[model samples]
Target: MLLFDFMFSETLNASLVQSSLVCLATFSAIIWWLRPSRSRSLPPGPRGWPILGYLPNIKFSEWCNGYQTHDVMCKLAEKYGAVFGLKIGSKDVLVLNDYESIKEAFHHTNMNDRPENAMIKNIDNLGTGILFSCGDKWKEIRKFTITKLKSFGIGKRSFAENITIEAECLNSEIAKIQGNPFYSRPLLEPATLNVISSILLGQRFSYDDEELHFILDNLHRNGKVVGSGGALLFVPSLQIFLKDKIKEYRHNLDVVLKYFRGIVSKHQEEFDPYIEKDYIDAYISEMRHNKDKGKQSYLDVSNLVMTLGNLFAAGSFTTSETLSWAILYLTKHPEIQKRAQEEIDNVLNQNQPRLEDKPSLPYTWAVVLETMRLATVGPLGVTHAVADDTRMFGCEIPKGTMIMPNLWNVHHDPALWSEPNEFKPERFLNENGQVEEPPQLIPFGTGRRSCPGEQLGKMELFIFITHLLQKFNFKEAEGESPLTLEGSLGLTWSPTPYHVCAHSRE
Candidate 1:
């Protein structure tokens, strides 16, 4: 009887202690909520649920469809005006619609950091690469990559020659298809990969290389998965809800990383820093130099992998997808197609088109520009995060806020362009029939985190598209008369599978 009574007393005391702790926690939360430093004026936005944010308004159905997603966001921008707020999962994202706002927001150094999301958040090592990294690490890598790419022939004639050769190979591959209805991916992908791969590893994969094909296919699949933005992509913990998808994501990334690792490992042994070869050699030299200083933070193995991964992913898809758009647009508009062909023929005249001819082939270049504007490759570019408390055009954006620059809105704004819906390459042409670079045509985005691969991509598009038009004509398949402009939006937006007959001009 005495033992039972003593146990009951102990239980009661434990319950009382638990109650006190709960009360203390409750009080602390209340005090924190009321604290002046804890609250600030967030931009106007729709309120969301406890964990899930404004995802309800931005429905999955619309997101799954590329065109529909833009249409929805366009409507929201119309209602929300130039600046509004949203909560993508836990991310407090601020949408900058107009060109001026986007320019100003992007230019702010405080707004330069890449937003922390599931994609980078769950990375084995957080903030390691050029694309998803933040702060000094990102800054260091971006600058280093741009400088190295220049030395390795990215924006130079030598690089253009490399792309031209790839174009020749691509033309040959397309010829093998014999003008039959075929998916453009298999042909376009390998050629694009070869260009970037040559720049990175100093070698290009043959079209029939099975291992290379595996990397290309998975790279594309991963790109699409990343493009299909999700809660887990923005909120890492939500990955718990997508066990199967997370497994696939990890597997795909592993395959690509393993392939790159093999290349990087090979380069580590054969790399000669004193003699410049490619991006890999240049990076190894940097790592070697920094080793003595004990400041080799950014030039290690993992970083090399992530940076190369991004370069591969970014350089490959957007350019190829833009080419896909080119085929779709030009084929659909026979008159436009004829004009482009005329320009190519006049400029080259029995010679293969070169980057030197880009300036001379104004209409052909204009077609490329218009395609970029019409179906912007990166519609919602890499999301950025606010570094500190900042203001943009009177909107108060607190620290840790995410910035979503709607390239679609900027490209399609009625106030910015007349008849924005119409496919008019001539708009990019001047009275003297020269190609004019539109200040607002920011398909690759603007400011700090904007695509460093833009110049390379432009050169590739011009060389490949012009050469293809020079060699053959892209035609509609028997039943695929009207090529649908509808695209499947992923990390990059690409056209839906459509059959095109490549007719040899010879």
Candidate 2:
């Protein structure tokens, strides 16, 4: 009887211990779920799920609901104010929604670094390019690239002749369609690419060049893939599940890189320091000079390849896409197109548009500015990072925090633009009937890290738009659905594929 009593006591003790442990676990979980998510130092934002944070929300909204990443961010900003915080995976993301916030944050020296995320690191393993590199390397390469490109007539009036030549080529391509409805990207992209190519590769590719077509095809495809799969960069653990997408992204990037590598190799073989033919030749000369000095420098073969890749990708894609958006908008709004053409006609008198004629054509320039504002191609801009723990706009941003400048928000902000959704070129004009670009019109971003190609891009826009409008009238295709201004987000916010009838103005 005593032994039986002891056995019962032991069984009861075990049950009590097990029950206590279960309760403790349940209580702990509740505390974790209900914990104060907002750090006193951080900006206000949603209290997302434990561990995963706001990543799932972003993915679901983008994948399931067809919302663009920028659209999702704008919605969050509506609730959280201009400065919002989010914990994306293991990183802290601070999104600057207003022009003030973006301007201050981008100009801050400490806030100038690029995110050293897995995906970014994978793109240029050496981290040698101007777009993604930080610190001295970026500064050195950027300065050199800018100086060299200028010498090659990138931003100067001398380059206007080359652009005019390319514009003529594009005009011929469009004229081939003979007023039939056609997609503009195929013609526009190559024309823009050739302009940049003259500076970078020192030669132009014929429209039917097999190699150029292959590179362009891959580059365009990768832009879309990056938009859809870019979240993987923020939450790398998800890569395991989305291996196929990651693989495709890598493959596309690899194909482009392979072509660039061959070009770089050919340049190296034919490199002559005394005679600099193009940007590549100038870079090789610099590399050799550094070598001759026995100096440890970032100007090496790897850096050159990656820098060229960055230049080629950025130099062509954004400008071409912006032009595509311009054409789409003009096609949809024929009145705007006619007015712009009239302004061009009045200014140029049937002559090819020149860079110097920009000031003389206020309405046409306004049209370009308006298109840039409405389209907001790089909607999210480039993701920035804090080099150290810093305070920005009354929030304590942690070191290595990911900074997202929601260019879309700033462009579409009701406070900044009247009827922000509508296309109004006059918004860019003042009472004086001259072009007036407000400080808020930051289509290529602003501050130190703004696009180096800004001037060149503007030059391209002015030259191409004026020339195109001078020679042709763009309108919606007959028997086709109206083109929507709503753009699909990729590496850029590009117009949906639509056919435009380009009738000869002559």
Candidate 3:
């Protein structure tokens, strides 16, 4: 009995020793993981607990959330100056609130590459689509796209011809409303979608078509998902644990990618390189040619799919939002609207307003400028990641730091503009009554990764505004506030749903 008891005690002692050793190993592992890497030094900001980072502080509600993000970052800028740090789940992002810091980080070539985020990779893999690609691949593809866009009539006669058709269609649709308070989605979406569709697929859909509706809805939803809670993308392992949200994201991407794939597959069977018809056909031909020569090409089938996706999604949102805001503002300020109409009518004299006419109609241009400033989409824009450790505004931003350019802060900065909150077009006009472009209104962002679609976007806005204002006087629906500027946060800031009645100039 004595011997058995001693043996039992020895076994118990061994077990306790093993448990203590295991605890020590686990504690050491935690310490090692939390310890900052010896590679590079990072900028300073609020510290977070291990693993989760500052994600707990991220509020996801749309209305309060966007403002909260803007305000919090602004406060941090006050405390930390232009450059500061933020953590979203084990990841640190350096936020750039002022123009000087933004230019230093974004405009310089060293900081040009896209960040190493899973979502960015997912986007790149799903389609080395223009929005997410980096390096020589990006430069080659972008150069090709720029060349193609220009050749196909960006700032050329072909583009003008297409815009005229879309303008006519938009005008005809508005005329159908007969001066009633009709929701403009049916008319506006098709017009905007076709601007891209004609460029990409060489096709256009009627506003009432079911397929177009489905595509638009899916695009809209995907944009919302990507723009919000997209930080989920950076932590892919969480996808396995949080299966439902990732599944939804996958489903949305699959739906759009599948649609694009179908288009590409059809083009592959019947595409003609010699013809050089539409964007996809040109890409398909290029892809095949590269494959034959054993040279890697950016215009692969996946890229074609994503390129169309990027073109459709990116092109549609900002233009639509800007137009929506312009209409709303005109409705609120009737006198300004009247003056714009007068300028369009007097300058063009029943002729379609050309791009060159933009200079002649200073007030008309001012209205567009004000719309851009007041309704800057992506108030936060897309979150950009640092390519490497860098300094901005005297702060140390480590490599792999995500950069958020606060375009909202830039557009609304009281230091830059007088009465920053007011919707004043006159601010953009010089004492000489000419439209003076301000570098401070950075609606399109700046630097190596700035938006490539700026000229197209500006053209679309000018054409749409010219046609709409010339034909109809926008007015508030009864008992509605025309000055109401509510935006739902997404990959872009979109106006909250509202209706404006079109009063015909007839």
Q: Rank the candidates by lDDT, best first.
A: 2, 1, 3
TM, every model: 0.88, 0.90, 0.87
Best by TM-score: 2
Candidate 1 residue lDDT tens string, 1-506: 00000001122357665885477457656664454321136556555433335553455435364334555667777787877776655567787888888898898899987656565444575335687778888888888999988888877898899999999999999999999988887788888888988888888989899877887788767654555443445565444445556566678888788788888888889877567777888888888889977884676778888888888887887888889889888888989999989877776888988898878999999999999999887777767888998876566778888777888888998887789977899999889999888789999889877889888989999999988899888889987556787776666767887889899988
State the lDDT of candidate 2 residue by residue for 1-506, as single tens digits: 00000001122357665885477457647876576544446788876544445665776686677777788889999898989887665467788888999999899899888766455455544445787788888889999998987898876788999999999999999999999999999898899999999999999999999977987888777665566555555556445545656677778777787788899899999887788999989988888888899988888777787788788778897899899998988887889999998888887898779999999999999989998999988888888888888867776778877788888889998899999988899998989999999999887888888888998999999999999999999988889887877777666778888899999988
Per-residue lDDT value at 66 in model 2 = 74
lDDT of 2: 0.80
The models' CA-based lDDT, in order, is 0.76, 0.80, 0.72
What is the Cα-based TM-score of model 1? 0.88
Worst 10 residues of 2 by lDDT: 1-10
Q: What 10-residue stretch in candidate 1 is worst by lDDT?
A: 1-10
Regarding TM-score, does 2 or 3 come out ahead? 2
Each model's number of backbone clashes? 2, 0, 2
Error in Å for residue 70 of model 2: 1.4
